[model samples]
Target: MAARSRRMTLPSLAGRIDPIYKPATKPTSDPAHSAAFIFLHGLGDDAEGLENIADQFQKNDKVSYMHWVIPNAMEDRDAMTTAWYRPSPLTAFAPSRPELEEEEDEQGLVKSAAYVESLIDACVRKGIPPNRIVLGGFSQGCALSLFTDLTSKKYSGRLAGIVGLCGYLPLAGGSQLQHLRAIAELPPTHGDVPIFLARGKGDSLIPKRIWNITLKGLEAFDASSVEQHEYEGGHTINGPMLRDVCNWLEKVVPKLED
Candidate 1:
């Protein structure tokens, strides 16, 4: 056994951001067989709040090949709450303002993006191959994950999958899409990275129309690589959704001990 490792949180982006992560327990002692799942939390939530959810995978005999990572958002709000970046309205078409700007910071977005990129580099350094890593998040975290996937040049290699929960792509309007196209296109990493997007049918903040737009934009890249699911509830995760996520992992991740 390669000495049972402990959780570690590291700083990134010139110390502007931090991410909390737990190394996956290897089913065996093989270093090359390990995988990682990076989890990003929603707005107003911190790494500690989501760490418990990551711990859920610890019990699965099939999950030992994977590590769970929860990256803390850049901005910390009242008490222990955190956010990746300030979220604006989905677009002009979004319903209600929905308290998007309690503390808006543009520079924070740049810093946050840099922080996430650094975290990915850290994962590679930790001996987990890029192709075996899955990046995921809830709400605001999902938005950041999508943005990072599309923008980061480092994402070209070793990206296995991306999971977005109750989130939408930040770029709106054709001009922004054109800019994204000029920089890079969707399914950015590996040319065939699988993407899973899950949302609640009753989510008031992220309405069905917004999800529709996201799906449309993703389809522009590689429709086959994108998969979407809608649950019955609102603005939160449910049991079936978790099961679906686990199943998705089983399919994408290699070397899972049956």
Candidate 2:
């Protein structure tokens, strides 16, 4: 067995927030073993919070070869918690509420998208190709992941898949929405990047109506390439969802060695 290389960097942001990303994991013994999963934590969570989920996959023989990269969101609050961005004013800083008024510039959306792009670039520098990378996040992190997947101009080349847990797609009628629509029109450069969306059936944060809207938007954008699953729970993740995620990864990621 060989030692793996891990690197970390903090990138500057426009506002007070600065994004910190973990370096890619390079398998020391097997340089050729290359696949990566980037996990983004939701509001009130830090990069270290997702370690349990990553550890779950590490126990899986089928996914042992994969490298996990969990990035901390830039907008840290209370000197302890982090969030993709400040909650929209319309929602009154509560994700459980809906934004009655639309944003003028989609500032939060754009900022978060840029932060994700920075993380991707860091991965590229550390030797992970886009095709072998799986972008995923939970809750608010899911929102950022979806926004990046839809708006990124550089998202075309290579991608393994995208997984969103208890998340919804970005709302329509903005620059972000337009970019997503345009990306949908173009031929998929990654050959139907598999999408897995799982939400708790009783999630009050992302109500049933919002989930329906998310599905509808995906459908409208020709995102028929999605897989949706619902669990009987609330805002938190459960064992079944984790198991399903692993199953999906087995189908999407390349095979691992014994």
Top of the candidates by TM-score: 1
Per-residue accuracy of model 2 over 1-258 as CA lDDT, tens digit each: 111224534354444333333332325344334677788888788776887777666654446667777766664453345667665322213355335563433566677777677767766666667876789999888877776776677863257788999987766433457655375564433246788999998888888777876787666656656999999998888999999988898788766452
lDDT of 1 by residue, 1-258 (tens): 121225433444342334555666654365446777888888887677777666776766556678776776654553245677766555426446545533334455556767777777766776667888788889988877776666566774247888999988666323454354456543432256788899999898888878887787766555367888999999997888988988898888867444
Clashing pairs in 2: 7-23, 130-158, 131-158, 131-159
Model 2 poorest ten-residue lDDT run: 1-10
Q: Using alpha carbons, what is the TM-score of model 1?
A: 0.81
Q: In angstroms, give how far residue 129 of model 2 lies from its true place.
A: 1.6
Error of 1 at 65 (Å): 1.1
TM-score of each: 0.81, 0.78
Clash pairs detected, candidate 1 = 24-67, 130-158
